[model samples]
Target: MLLTVSGPPGSGKSTAAAALATALDYEHVSGGDVFRELAEERGMSLGEFNALAEEDDTIDRDLDRRLREISETRDEVVLESRLSGWMAAEHADLRIWLDAPLDVRAERIAAREEKPVEQAREETVTRAESEALRYREYYGIEIDDLSIYDAVLNTARWGPAETTELLVALAESYDPQTDEGTFPVSGVRYEF
Candidate 1:
């Protein structure tokens, strides 16, 4: 099974994906990890790298290409990234968008990075705008659209363990044989 987990910054996508992959005994691939590695290798901050990407599309393109390659060839994998849902839509068995309110997400970021909540909020918004602009200009993708996701969950409502347990259960219970069926969301299944 190929599962793609996507959401905005500090939405716990990477953590959730890793937990889900572990529960399912799947390989976990994180696009953010790759992006961060590149930034570190170049001896630059994430903000600097993101700014450079705005000028040079190659940075985003290269990372996206690597994600596509993994999705195309791999099975039993969990791919996590902001655009992973869009990139792995065709190959993914489940495309999940895990997010929370901007403030909640920002708070999580602040806690994780040990920065002030206000500072984290500003950085998150700036990074999101930068990526959104580039994604639109380069790929014609509207990142805000949730139509592609099979499941959408609010990470702020649950801790990592609970979220992982819920997702693992959902993945196991999903019936792939039912083509063009509805997905359960907050106890209500909505048909497409």
Candidate 2:
């Protein structure tokens, strides 16, 4: 089964995805890894690369293209990114969108990055806005839309371990043989 785990920064997406992947014996592929690779390739900071990505559309396209390929061809894999649900499309057996309140997310991010909460909060907000705009312009995707997801989880309500258990239960209970339906993605142009 292909599982898509998507969420904003500091929302415990990476943590949950890692745990879910291990619990289910599935490989985890993250867009963040690719993004970091792109950044390192350019000899630039993440902030600088993010700014460049906003101006140069290909950066995001390249990242999405790789993840999409993995999703389209792989099974028993966990695909994770802010837009992983959409990137996985019909190939995903379970599409999950995890999120938390901005304040909670900022605090989590602060601890992980060893940064100040206020600084994390401001950067998180700015990055989200920038990525939302890029997603809209590049693929006609509205980050606010949740209709495509099978599960929408608020990570603030649970710690990473609890969230992983919940996801494992959700996946174990899913029976593709008696599947209801997979909402088809349409209208958007996938140039990647």
Candidate 2 differs from the real structure by a C-alpha RMSD in angstroms, to one decimal, of 5.8
- Runs with alpha carbons beyond 4 Å of true place in candidate 2: 180-192
CA lDDT of each prediction against the hidden true structure: 0.88, 0.87
lDDT of 1: 0.88
Please give the distance, in angstroms, between residue 97's alpha carbon in candidate 1 and its true position after superposition.
Answer: 0.1
Residue lDDT tens for model 2, 1-192: 999999899888899999999999999998987898889999998788999999999899989998899998998999999988998896898888898999999999899889999999999999999999999999999998988888888988887888898888778877766664322233221110
Listed per model in order, the count of residue pairs whose N, CA or C atoms clash below 3 Å is 0, 0
**Per-residue accuracy of model 1 over 128-172 as CA lDDT, tens digit each:** 999999999988999998888878889888899988987887678
Candidate RMSDs in order: 2.8, 5.8
- Give stretches of model 1 more than 4 Å off: 175-192
For model 2 the TM-score comes to: 0.92
TM-score of each: 0.92, 0.92
> Would you list the clashing residue pairs of candidate 1?
none
* Model 1 CA RMSD to the hidden true structure, in angstroms: 2.8
